[model samples]
Target: MHLRFHALATACACLFIAPTLRAQTTSPTLVTATTNDTSAEQVVVTATRGAKAVEKIPGAVSIISRQDIEAQGLVSEDPSALLALQIPGYAPSRQKLSNFGEGLRGRNALLLLDGIPQTNPLRLGGREGYFADPMIVSRIEVVSGASAAQGLGATGGIINTITRTPTEEGTRHTVELKYGTQFHGDSASWKTGYMLEHKSSYDLIAYLGARNQDIGVDGAGRPLATESLHRAADVFVKLGKDFGPQRLQVMFNRYQADGFDDRVDVPGDRATGVPTTSQRGTLPYDAPRNEVRSASLEWTHNDLAQGTATVQLFKQDFSARYSGGVIATFQDAAIAPVGQLIDQSEIQADKWGLRASWVRPDLWTRGLELTLGADYLDDESQQRLTQTGRVWVPPMTYRSLAPFAQLEYEIGPLTLRGGLRNEHSRLKVDDYSTLAYYGSRAVQGGERSASKLVKNLGAVWRFGNTGWSTFAAYSEGFGSPDVGLILRAVNSNGRSVNNLVDLQPILIDNREVGVTWRGSRASLSASVYRSHSDLGSQLVVSNGIGSVQRVPITVRGFEVTGEWRPLPDWQFNGSYAITRGRTASTAGGSLDLDLGARSQGPDKLVLGALWRPAPGWQAHWTQSVYFSRDANEGKFSGRTSLEEHFKGYTVADVALSWDSPWGKLGAGIENLFDRRYITYYGQANYSGTAEDYYAGRGRTLTLSWRRTF
Candidate 1:
């Protein structure tokens, strides 16, 4: 059946492009810088390991420009929310600082900062998405689905946050201030930031920035204790020099957030799934503290070995303390007779790596390009109890070396791309004792190593002069379970980690077909994909503790997006996504079971319009819709076992901006109708009954001003 579907989809795509094949022999004109042209050329680096036009890439890719970022006025500190809003197949935001279950294409995605990995795959804390502030970001690039271009943790795809760089040869300064508050309540917050850039005539540039923000409350006028408090300050600096044939750049960033809230959650009614809440009181745990520090140096040499060669070295240190929660209950011999809840777990990670790549276009053949790269990474991570200083996840170190190559060949109207990556990694862990659940469990750690070769193949057919293109791709992705978690919780008496052969790496196969049409006033794209894994890892939460469960599963989805410009000053855009998944079960002689909310989310739709009625004045509005979903969890076998029947909902947002001599003034309202709604995760798979389930914030009004000199 899967093969039949793939063939049909491919045939349909080819049929759509057949009309324009005759124009393939003619030379195509490259789009130049023109103000009147609505379509602007975009270059992407992550998709192909080198700078390439977005339209030429044979994959699901989206670019969120700087202008788009400013226009959205995203309130959530996690940029994942921004991606969810713009890109299809991205799960909806959980509204928390964490990205626990935020999967792309139903799998883990790699997070990158200037081509450096930010994820701690060995520990798998799920906080890699929020490493930096969006203010310093120049643009965001997203590539959906599996590919060999990136090494580990890219079972889903890659998201690279490109930082701003100096453009002109002059000194420039900018400052921004923003204030926000609930419409019907006094949950107010403010943020301030400043940036300085100096570009010298001698091909040298320096950039620096600093920002600070305060904590805020929720829509219900309740302090957001569990939600990531924003008492944070961040600073970044960059220095660059260009010496005609070679260029060098160095960057450093530091961010810290710490705050204490007097609040706790009490369990509410379980039948209705109502959450618990608290007015005021400090919990018996340490305050939340999150710190991230990073540094990188990059060098680029042109015409090295008849190609462009680039090398980068980077290091990152990250530590985060989560709020107190009822993770586990264990009894102490001298402290208590009965088991008590142990709250607070902190994660610390250090990562450093070196990456080098060379790109040579038209190497020995016309319309053929070759790119080769090698990467080396060393990561150390550990998780501990902040209260008693007891290890939860034992310290683990990972070393990886990967070599990859990609080739692109263009012939007539069709472009073919293929790549291969060899991944070799070694993980080492020392012996450690586990926390006392019923009793202290001893774990014997050891070393494990794995090597895999993944491949990707794709083809894009462009209908010359028609502004239409279609692509088909097949790729493979690889992922490993959180070894530390598995090794630390060994309950089997006298079992060593090395003896546990059940924990094996998972590989996923992805197939996709897509079509895109771009005209003078309209653009549309549609894609269908299927991804399957014989051995897939699913996060299972029981009694507030999460663990991985391996299962055979298949996921299929489709996405459609369109944009139209009815008038020169007015534009409308929309997108829709539908995803369905199933897993194999051995309940009664191997049955295909429906994946619940814990593994899959509901369908999503977004519609918006932007209008610039007058010069320097802009207005925008957006509506987001989540369709209902009901999937049964066979374990429970009742209404409660259904994992919260998600109901459909629609939310609206509006914003306006105006240019002024002093600065640019902006005002916006989120949740325009103040319609209270439950978040998708909250409704489907919220682990705790006491904490406020994922409830959408109430109406919020934001005012901001910015100036540049």
Candidate 2:
């Protein structure tokens, strides 16, 4: 029985780490590290790309600083709703900007920006988790399950982000403005930003930024029929230099979200969830557009061969457009009838990559360290039909090559990591026709390749006098499938693309265990995980058109996070999670079922409190809960007969900050008791479309101001 449920979840994670290893066997003192330690044992650079030290990394990591993303981007600038409010099996937040099936531990994650690769794995665009502009983020790491030390779409782990640097030396400038509304109407939003930095005098540095936003509505006051139309603009730049130890950098970013709105969708009453609108004016197409551009060039060397070398070269270009739906059916005879509505559709991608790494902390001895790297990608991607321009996802051109190695050692209190990766990929594709419905299908592409190696082991014991830590890991992840939705859904006619064969490539397999304690006031961490794949890809819609289905899944989870500083300016935080998933159809079969809402999401809790009381006032509060799901355990994907479900909710938020003298001021409120709910992928009746039923977004009030000079 799956090895007795993986040996009873590894004996309940070794009885929850055996009383923190017997209270760390007679505590003493030790534990000190600081850069103003923001806990979780600080120092992380995406868990082992270099920098390690999140208790020596071994599963479930999270960082999100920069003052917690400027205090949650002052209530939602949506980085997938701030990583589903601080990542714990993240996934939730379909406030629509398309992160369709926003996954993390259940698969498909690997978005990065400061470390290149903004997902487009051969045309799988779930909008790479909102690329850019969390006000030019300055931190956000997250590394959850599967890991081959990052190569290929981290089968459910890795979110990088990190941008904003210029730590002291000269000119600085900043300005921000925000405004929000909908406490019960006008539905407003506004944002403006600017930033600049310089630090010269020989070791140069520079940074720049820009931001813009406008458009809002919801909470039943309407507008936001399936979201999109929150106009956007973002720009970024960075440059650096420091030759003494060899360093160089360059970066660029640009984002744009255009406008075009006419309104449509107005269907509600899915057994009383009452919400879903838009339909009061023009409508047909033109309303969603997206563009993203990125660039990078980096190099570093801190005495190379002895190790600490880095290099990066990256590029990205993305495009999006959606707003015209309804595909399939044309009744032969000239191009026009039978449910015609193709209005528009678009997707484009271009990625370029190269990453290099080397780290060696006495590689051949003394506490070992090592880490070598190589990665390269070239993606092309495509999809189209901006009204009959045809070709619906048939450009394809992925290419990859990875090489990796990792090793960490530290005797004394144990810490022995291991890693290996190989990965190789190739795709190609050309010949294409489909898109006039099975009758116009032609399909016949070429080249397909794959290779894998993946492996990672882990350990971390750490007790150094007390602070406690424990870990256990085993990782492996790899992905594929979405090769432009299996070559544009080739409907057979002398198929090709290597005879499709379900476009293989998926290999998960995670397993984790964790524990952490940190005291002086209180800190806690906990984890238990399990992931499995065996040919898993599952996205099925059928009549509403969405494909990919290769069963055999299994996911399991548990997480708990905590912090408490009784007083001393007060602090309290919390987190909780419990996830479950299952599936089957072959490949070591017998999973039985239930793995849906686009792969499980729901079972969460979070609570927070922070009060600084004086020296620059600060106050924050939070509460979130979501737990409900059972419409046959949520397997919706074109479900009909109206039995959709998901119904537990509790939300609250508040914020206040001050540190004036012309610098900062903030205010916030979000869904604070406005109660109107329905979101968790809007109860997941998957595409029984009506813009996929929606709601959730009502009480909101925000204000902000910042300045620096």
Candidate 3:
């Protein structure tokens, strides 16, 4: 059911499929070094590990700078709230406190800090970059499709967050303090970020933050959700030493986050008491505790003569504890329930990886470049259940190795880029023991060597002085199945897996292309993309007893995005996405189940814009209108269903900011019109359907202050 060593071996073999490249360009110069402080906003990244203005990258991409963040009052709380309004298809819920945890609020976008991956394969669809710092961000780079060089998990796209780099060119110190309000509780956050550098070759940057919010109840008259408290810190240091014909630099970074969303379910309420959101539920709350930590180090050398070589080592861990579920009579009482009342489940893991890359510039022709890299990863996980205060583990390990290459060339006004990658992945189950009454499991232990192949090609042509550029790109990426999920579920811990059939790796292939036109008066960038996945992990069914299953299906969709800046202060941008998914096979196969459960969703779309008529003042706004009727599994067909098929709704938001000599001041209102909507839905337990709807907050105000010395 899981991808194993086969994937690794196959991917490694693919390294020889491509031809050599010839190109030249030594170091990535500073953005400020090439600009006169004007048009710094047009710098491009990710297309190359370096900088090139957007006009030069051969594919579709977008940028959201630090200026955009501050002017939009993104200084405190739910940073995802803003990204949801920006990236197309990337969805993060606006409501902080909810039953199924944070649902997709903003973009479904894959997020990165420096060069580390923060996506969670186990918990599909929930974006985790919400915990990052926008205050210290140098620039936000968004590449619209799968690029073999960007690593795995980019079926949707890539959002790489580049932190500020300290340089002797400028000296600056900044800090921000902010307080905000929703319909109920008061929220506040403090951030301190610094960049230090001298004319010397050494530079360092750091960011630390602490934020808190007391939650309130939903309109259902149940306890409002309150996420306990959180504290996070990130630090990075770079030491660059110059050597004859080459520059060597060493870099290191560390990050940590911890908190809990404690939801007290009001099981009982005063009969005569007004049915306020808080009075809806009186059951004891279900509180979840979780934490994420990561560390990475890298070394780079540009003049290997043969090419540029870089190597890195990293460790990442994510752990969580769930301790508040309603008491349930054992679904299967054949065996003593260890005392009857059942409560809770958890996911604990550890991952370590190493990466090495080499890039050769122009071995044969001018304007030709080639890059080669490989990654090795080891993942370990433990799944446990609490029975009358007892804990059990159905442990497992998942590992993978991948190597890739890319080539790029330019002739006159035409530029083209192409690349490919192969991943060899392996999975194994260890110390797996116990119970048959509950179900079918991975045969004590087994291995799978599922290899995946990724490829990309892009080209762009500039039409002289007319100010028009033609662009198009084709790329592929795969969405992999969670090996750890398979190990635990089959071991009798999660339901369906107990008496179920078989499991297989879900696979997805994605493709995209686009074009753009810009002139002195206006500019527009538009592109369309589509993705298809077979053996896809689709939610099959879940019985209230905390058991669930997935069937291999086909999920495919198309999307288009556009933005036009008519004036220095006026810009309009928006994106639209639609997905059509269904079971690929049902008649005959190793996997079979009525799974009457439908897995699909209505098409999704959003439109918004940023307007800044002057330097000291800026206004930003956006709206999202859903077409939920297109959704599947009868998610909105229940009691709390706001609308059959989650009737599409529209909401507005606006932000204004002013820069003063003393500092920068800003304010904004989200869901300005108080419209209600669901960003994402579905859960593995309790409600077998996508019943988990994350609420969109009503009108809320945010304020911020920042100063630099």
TM-score of every candidate:
0.91, 0.34, 0.77
As for candidate 2, its clashing pairs are: none
C-alpha RMSD in Å of predicted model 2 compared with the true structure: 24.7
Off by over 4 Å in 2: 1-57, 61-82, 88-94, 100-153, 156-279, 282-322, 325-391, 394-431, 434-443, 470-476, 485-517, 524-562, 567-571, 574-607, 610-620, 623-709
lDDT score of residue 592 within candidate 2: 64
Best candidate (score: lDDT): 2
Q: How would the candidate models be sorted by TM-score, starting from the highest?
A: 1, 3, 2
In angstroms, the error of model 1 at 492 is 1.3
Give per-residue CA lDDT, model 3, range 1-709, as digits (tens). Answer: 0112332342233223111100001001111110113242366646565445666666556566666555545423455655555544444343442222221111124566666666655443232544355655766677655455565556556777776666544455667776666645433334445544433444455555554444433333133333333445555555555565455555455544444443332322222322212222332433455555666676767678668777777777765555444334222344455454445655566777887777787859988888778878787766454443332345556677888888878788788888888877766654453333335332345554568777777777878766566776777665555444444444444333222233344444555454454444333343444454444444332343322334444333444444445556665655554444344323233322211212333344565565666767666666665554422343321243211233455666777777878787878776676554433432112142322333444566677777866
Worst 10 residues of 1 by lDDT: 21-30
1 or 3, which is superior by lDDT? Answer: 1
Q: Candidate 3: worst 10 consecutive residues by lDDT?
A: 18-27
Cα-based lDDT for every prediction: 0.71, 0.72, 0.50
Candidate closer to the true structure by lDDT (higher is better), 2 or 3: 2
Candidate 2 per-residue lDDT, tens place, 167-284, comes to 8888777888888877443367778778777878433323333343333455556654545545677778888888878888888888776544755667776666666765556656
Steric clashes per prediction: 0, 0, 58
Give residue 401's lDDT in candidate 3 (0 to 100). Answer: 83
Q: How many backbone clashes does candidate 1 have?
A: 0
Better of 1 and 2 by lDDT: 2
